[model samples]
Target chain A: MAVKYYFYPLWLRFWHWLNAVLCILLILTGLSMQYSNPDFPFMRFDLAVSIHNITGILLTASYLIFLVGNMITGNGRYYHLNLRTISTELMKQFKYYTLGLFRGEKPPFPINEKRKFNPLQKISYAVVMYVFIPLLIITGWALLFPEITIHDVFGVSGLHLTDLLHLIIGFFVSVFLIVHIYFSTIGATPLSHFKAMFNGWHKTHD
Target chain B: MMIKGMRIQALIWMFFFMIANAGLFAQQTDSIPENVKENQKCLKCHGNKYYSYYNDWVEGDVRERMNPFYVIDSAEYYNSNHKTFTCIDCHSYEYEEFPHPGYLRMEPSYSCMDCHGFGDEWAKFNFEEIQSEYEKSIHSQKHNETFSCWMCHNPHEYKISARTEENIKEVIAYDNAICLNCHADIDEFMFIAERENPNVLETHDWLPNQALHFKSVRCIECHAEQSDTLLVAHNILPKEKAVKKCVECHSDNSLLMASLYRYQAKEERNKAGFFNSALLGEYYVVGANRNYYLNLISIVLFGLVVLGIGVHIVLRIINK
Candidate 1:
């Protein structure tokens, strides 16, 4: 039997889709500015700077909204970890994805009304959301207002350090986006998760 | 008792001598022929190629008889615009005396503006604009010791760049050398600065490709005030106030457009294709020098990512 659950709420769904749009725009504009050239431009130099700045500001706002919504909503609870089961459950989920799924073995953790994310999803989401995103945002803000950055740290210039950090983190986040989108197809149907984000319902086999 | 009394008398004599000859040391005079003759007499000792600090022993009862400040390089003096006019043309007339009146040393020194600012005779040199910019410089901010143009520009050897080579690289080196003479030397910097001198290399380590930048541009490109009136801005800002943002130079509206490249021939700048296209003819600035190959590489890499995603989707469909 298959079941449909009202897993993603309206506000969470809205934030997720909005974030998707903002992230894509930011990625394009950021890459364009970073790779801009005089002889052959990825985009017009002026246009890249303007678009990157504007999109980055918008993404900052979206990030804040996401933070505030998580604070006031039940969706945040799914991100909370169970220390006892974390390691064991994470291993189980990893194996299920890597080999068990193709071998037609049952999933170690399945989505239900009581649980929104598997252990692997919870840990990865927590790291990307809580750690990488915050760092990126901080470095991004530091770049925007260079005066706020430290003048020097261990003989390294703070601005250069900040710029390098932003570039590396941006690259990782971009890669995560690619893999995240691909894995979105791993549900019961390839388009099932995409539909759930739009309609706030997740259909699962019971 | 007689020897003690003689020593006391000698001490009193020395005090009175110093008090009486206080105005004697001022260096210059106004008469043209007399100025040359007088200067030649003084230069016999002062203009010695090796005249560094003048403390040679003299056969006299005098203590500290030689004035270290009296030494000036004859080569540099002759190289200056004031060469034919003699030392006394700028210094006090009392300097003509073999043992100058010490009180004359207390007289104010003559800056270029003493004569140059007086009329339109040297207006073409833009001394007025330079003075105006200098007035607003961080160096001009009130301190224990007054800062002056002579600190950075040794008037004795400062050949006006505009009158010399327009090659610009040499001009940049000459101008930057003046700043480094003080900044790179802690002992020299201490004369003007109250705080401990910053380590130049450490302070500038944040500057990307520092050696390239140092060689290519004047220090004033980042440190000096940006002004519209002067060809080269003279108002040096404090370090904290200097341009720190990379975008200040890296962007399309590069500050170098008004500064470093300002001397570039119009035809050179007008040969532009895109932003900083003309700039590539001379040198490569990291952000400014956009290359076709790099842009293509980026496009190819991004296309590969999207293509990989499409391939995975196709594989998934086949499995389904």
Candidate 2:
């Protein structure tokens, strides 16, 4: 028998796709700005700057939605995984992926009403949503209005540090994006996880 | 009888004409600014270079230089910041006499602080702070009496271009001209300097993009002590004490801010936003004002991501 869980709500599904589109736009524009040649540019420098700023603002708004939605609904509890069992659970999941998955053994921790994500998914998603995104947002805003930033920090300029942090975090987010897409394919079927984000139902075989 | 009557009338008319002429001349002179209308009387002789000559001690040697006291470039004076001023406004009233007395030559010339030092009109220019800074400068420290405000700023020709010019490049060129006039020209340098005038180009050869640097910023930006309250610093540091470190102007907290870009920084409401919008504007400083560590990190991180993905795909295939 196959079980269908109403995991992704309409709002979450909408916000996810919106964030994905925005992230892609930001990445492209960001790369254009940092690496593009003045004469032969990937995108016109001025145009890329405008698009990046607009998309970043949109991402900020979308992030706020995720924050508020998590606060008001039960979705917040899923990210609050136990730190005590995390190491053991993470190792078990890591082993299962590397060994048991190829051997066609049963998943160590399958999705349930109580557990929306396995340990690996929970940890990575938690880090991306709670830590990396917030850092990127704060640094991005600091860069936009640098007057508010400290004049210097331990001899280095605050603006320089803020810009550097923003770039580093953006790079991490880009990496997470690639891996996120790759891991999404490793479900009951290749496209099952991607399909679940659209139709708001996660169908799994028991 | 007719000749006698005509002679008598002519004598009476001549007497009345002399009295009226004297009264009219007095009235006209009193109606005009006494010193203002007299510039032509002075410029007629002073404006012509060959009209006067003087021997002055320059660098301990007697040099027969043209008497600057009696000769001035009228065209330059007309174009100066004090173009509207009368000569007497800054000089003694005794100079109106011909063959000026030997004691009159000893009369002290007015400093910029004499008139600009007092009153609410000049309070906004921070002339007091400028004076204080100038007092501390190497010029003042070494040659207190010899180097007046006229040395760096010839009030006769200086137009306050740094404060008034619409184009910054023009301001830069005009400001540097003052320094180069003495530093670069051998004859001019000889007037003050005891040593040989070294080639300015060779002195600044260590600076990358020497021509661009000269055009981009005033000489004071590196050579002067920066003040938080002053628009342009007056404390001219000695060449040995001048900023030689590349990072002084190249780093994020560039000295250019305290010197060259101070006005723009003060005026900009949003500092980062202003730079962002003016990415291709005149404010853009390439190579100097840049942070590349993040860029390098971004490249390395991206490369690692690709490598990780490649290994992941290979591991999956092996398992399959």
Q: Which candidate is the best by TM-score?
A: 1
For model 1, how does the per-residue alpha-carbon lDDT over B68-143 read when each residue is reduced to its tens digit?
5556776677666666776767777778764678898688887878888867788766888899888888888754
Each candidate's lDDT (Cα)?
0.72, 0.77
lDDT of 2 at B294: 49
Q: Write the per-residue lDDT of candidate 2 for residues A1-206, one digit (tens) a residue.
A: 67889999999899899999999999888766655454444776556667988899999999999999888886888998799999999999999877787777778998889899999989989999999989988987876655567756775557666765776778888989998998887877779999999999998855
Per-residue lDDT of A1-206 in model 1, one digit per residue for the tens?
A: 78899988888888788888877777776776665445455676456556766767877888888789888875788899999979999899988866676567777887877788989889878888888878888888887666667856774457666765776677667877887898888887879999998999998854
- What is the lDDT for B279 in model 1? 51
- For candidate 1, the per-residue lDDT at B185 reads 85
**Over 4 Å off in model 2, which ranges?**
B1-297, B318-320
> Cα miss at B110, model 2 (Å)?
21
The interface root-mean-square deviations, each candidate in sequence, come to: 8.4, 10.3
Score chain A of model 1 by TM-score against the reference chain A: 0.93
Cα error, residue B254 of model 2, in Å, equals: 15
TM-score of 2: 0.50
Q: State in Å the error of residue B277, model 1.
A: 20
